[model samples]
Target: MISAKLLRVLAPKIARRYSSECAKDGFTVTVIGAAGGVGQPLSLLLKLNPAISELRLHDLVDVPGVTADLSHVETSCKMVFFTGTDHSEAICGADVVVVPAGVPRKPGMSRSDLFTTNAQVVYDFAVVMAKTNPGAIAIIITNPVNSVVPVVCEVLQKAGKLDPRKILGCSTLDSVRANVFLGEATNTDPKNAYVPVVGGHSGPTIIPLWSRSNPKLCLTNKKLASLTKRVQEAGTQVVKAKEGKGSATLSTAYAASRLTYCVLRAMKGETNIVESCYVASDIYPGLKYLATPLLLGKNGVEKNLGLGTINDEEKKLFCGAVEELQKDIKTGEEFVKSKNVK
Candidate 1:
């Protein structure tokens, strides 16, 4: 973690790159993989958010049915559907574009295992996001986010529409898990629990800082370590329990919706709206991105609240996660380079 003095000096400087755009009313939101497991449930939750005025759903085959189903809900959110690969209409002018467009994991499959196919799927959706609404907040919920987020950044940068401030990889799930696990371990209410998860989104790369937990936890070292490991391995545990049927769709939808609401609420002028997200950052050396808590605002990231003070064990975990994330980010940048770096 960086010093508070240094963070105070640098946060706003990094934040200045984003637009100061604000919204007086509700905003238009688009879901690129609206028919998928995570997308369907996420769309339902977003439809219920009072901040969204329009919800655009797009997919290859089943989006119409999904959108039609969501439209029946008693909400003022206007619904639209776009079938197939042509996402120009659905994505255009959206206030926020969320891409959960990728295949999910099965039993015994690591997140990295889905990188081959999901990377390309996320890449395609990102292209449309860059082209149609470069200024909109782009939230990525695809698997292998440690890599695919860099892929999206690369694609948008190539298109001359890169805005590091607004492009976020929704790492909120790790934080959500951290909160729940911490709460459960401490025998406190989960809703009152809050933990800041740093590093990347998968495996050993997920670092949950117990020092920052709200309601203050006082667990033994053994218990703390076990809880941290549980948060990192939670996705795998879920996949195994599902017996090859699906991944963490329901929980992921809930997590992604939390992130989406943060962005929407920020855009609508909510102050001090902070969330942990994987976005372009200089919080840690040698890695272009890390999941750090950020102060959200009208435009996007108003300030990066760098990882606060962590314990010896937390630092050790963070170091290892950083090393792994460096490779993960390279995997993403390399993919983009191979495809479009002319």
Candidate 2:
């Protein structure tokens, strides 16, 4: 048996190894809607991460309560709350700003239907971010993300602070779902499965690049089609499963946190880190924006990794997805233009 002194001597070495595994470099993360369903859990995950040294919780309401609750979880990170009309203080010095502050979709509601209500909310928050954390990498988790991301860019543009590299629509949930469903179908471990999901975040627009997936599992044409459909409709499945009480809040939080972890790791200069996110794109030549593979770095978006070789059937799906995505992009642009005119 090891003596207490020997155990103490080995503890620091163990911690260093663990930190290396977890990539624990200090980062300050601000969760804009810290009181909401996704925000609360996302914040908790960040706080638990040894990589994060500080967590700033901001919300229009209940921030203090949320901060108080999360602060009790014994962790290395310090928690700070900025509540009620003081949005600027919360984002003032953040390295990363996560916006999960919007309403959920109802049974009969399309994501676009939540636009009028969420647009102003996201726009107002974006304005604050422009002034305070202008250089921070902004991860947008609000619904109608295709539109909301454009709205964020427009807001930053109006402030003359738009940086295409710094804004991303958090579509990692779609990628996560794709991997999970594919794993379930193949009876493979989800952690080992690598799937790339592109396009917009809403129904019919999400494109899973099954052909480009690593480990290249062969699926019958029928099974492949079924898997693709399952990935696209996964959100609706969760909604129906919940019987209209809530959407995919918990799973979304998990996915968002995973994406945030990748970004944070990349921000610390960890090399070869790649993740898919919806950002201003030039990948498909004429397409204005897309969710594609990106190399994240300390300066944000080291490189926009374009799509790999896709099969003929996949190309057809890609074309259809881009068409729907263009409409989503236009809807966001129009919303911002109207807001500006008003």
Candidate 3:
């Protein structure tokens, strides 16, 4: 017996109430290397994220202490810890699983050098996720992401749980670094500088598209090359600066959290959330996986959003990146094949 005018007003209110309830439905995030330098800070960031209703910390050692320390935070998010064989418990029912569990990169070492050990670590985690939380969006922060991402993908495929959109290699760090470095050179705030970095996660495979940078920067070819090189070697620079004690943990955590937030927002049905991630794609011929900007959504990456406009120099760099990136990807595929991880 409601009037038409009353029904119109009530309908909008009901819709708003439903939206709020959906937003509060509780998101669970699991961190695989929760005791390491990257994991500790990454957990802190996840703890502070309002979208995450539960945070699961997993590691081989010292996870209990890390969990206890984070429990002191005033956030409403509940914290849990799992160690050793119980890592599977931490992963089950997770909405997002982040893998930063591996050996830290030392000075003078490329991400590829950490391959053999990290590949196995990432592989084991992928196996667990495929079995326990196959639908979860995986954000892999392990080194040699170009390869490790492929490793995870192949494992998931074997389990018949592969969703290309749900598995992502967190190459947002490269984009974050590009923004900061370009900000320094251009005297603009890094927050305002949007640089789309596409390619793989290491060395020449990291392609920073200066031509597509927001506010449109015009630099000489020499200057452009220098900035791109800096973005590519930025991790090495950080490793050396730390005197081989650590790699880029702080910045990496920030970037990973940024990407995680994007995923969470997308899960809440927020639209147009775009970020760079290394993911499986047929965008470029031959290479099965590469980093590019993706439009995130409720199910993870909704659109591939292939590389935007690039000039001659950038195109040449991209061609070279694809060649080297393919080799790294093959290495990962072969590693999984060797394990016979079905």
Candidate 4:
């Protein structure tokens, strides 16, 4: 029985009230493999997230100190530690689960080389997540992501809990590298450049579509090819630079954090949140899944925005990527099947 003029005045205030109330309900995020290079920094970054109410760190070892270290950070989010088999507690009721567990990639070792070991690790986490928190959005950061993501999907599907939209492979590192390198090339801020990196995560499969870069650049064919190659081999460059000490960790944590924030923002009902991630998609034929630009929303990937326009060079790269990616994906699916994981 409110008057029309009064209703309009109160509507904005009511909406603001609900938003503020929702903010209090914050999210709980769990990090599996929370002690490693990427996990430690990633956990610290998540600690800074205002919308996160709880940050759970789980690792086979070293979690107690890692949790204690992160607890000192001034943040509203409550920190929880889970070690050994008790890591199950971390997954319980988690809103988002990030898996970065597995052995670090040694120099001369490719993501695929880590696959045999990482697949089992990723599978174990997936099984627990599917059973306990099937509703949680899973971000798989374990390498050989092109394969690990599929393995996770298959596990969830077998458990009758598969929600493709809720599963994402963290390929944001590739996108981050592309943005930084391209920004450097153009004298633009990396934050301002939007480069859509599609295909897969490993060498030869990682395709950066310069034709679709926002704040686009004009470059010769030679320069474009060089930049694209740099994006694809950036990981290897880091591995070599580390003198076999470590792979890319700091930059990776930053990229993973960026992706996590994108997902969190979308969960908050933000509109038009687009990120490039490796997920199950129908964007290309023959390939069951690939990394493409996705418009994220409350339930996860709201829509799959396929590769826009690729130049001749990109098209050629895409063709080669499809061939290699298909094999990599098959390797993952086969790994799960071989384990009698149906």
Per-residue lDDT of 223-298 in model 1, one digit per residue for the tens? Answer: 8888888998899999889888889999999898888887876787768788999999998889898899999987
Please write out the lDDT profile of model 2 over residues 1-342, one tens digit for every residue.
334576446534533422334444578889988899889888876776667789999888888888988777666689998888668988888889999998887788876688878888788888888888889999999988888898888888888988999998999999888888768767888877888887778877788888877657589877888888888888898888989898899989888888787887777767887788999888886667789888988777889988787788778888888778888888888888987732
Model 4 agreement with the true structure over 60-162: per-residue lDDT tens digits? 9999999998777655679999899655789989999998999878887766679989998999998888879989999999998999999999998888999
Once fitted onto the true fold, the runs of candidate 4 whose alpha carbons sit more than 4 angstroms away are 1-22
TM-score per candidate, in order? 0.91, 0.91, 0.92, 0.92
Span of ten consecutive residues with least summed lDDT in model 1:
14-23
Model 2 poorest 10 in a row by lDDT: 11-20
Candidate 3 local lDDT, 1-342, one digit each (tens): 334576446434533422223355579999999899899988887776767789999999999999998887666789998999556889899999998999989976655679978998999998988888899999999988999999999999999999999999999999999998878878898888889989999999999998988757778999899989999989888898999799999999988988988888788887778999999999999999989999999899899998888889999999988879989999999999998875
* Clashing residue pairs, backbone N/CA/C < 3 A, model 2: none
Instruction: Sum up the clashes in candidate 4.
Output: 0
lDDT of 3 at 118: 94
Error (Å) of candidate 1 at residue 157 is: 1.2
Model 1 CA RMSD to the hidden true structure, in angstroms: 9.1
| Model 1, position 263: C-alpha lDDT score | 85
Ranking by lDDT: 3, 4, 1, 2
**lDDT values for all models:** 0.85, 0.82, 0.87, 0.86
lDDT of residue 221 for candidate 3:
96
Runs of candidate 3 with Cα error greater than 4 angstroms are 1-22, 110-112
The alpha-carbon deviation from the true structure for residue 291 of candidate 2, after best TM-score superposition, in angstroms, is 0.3
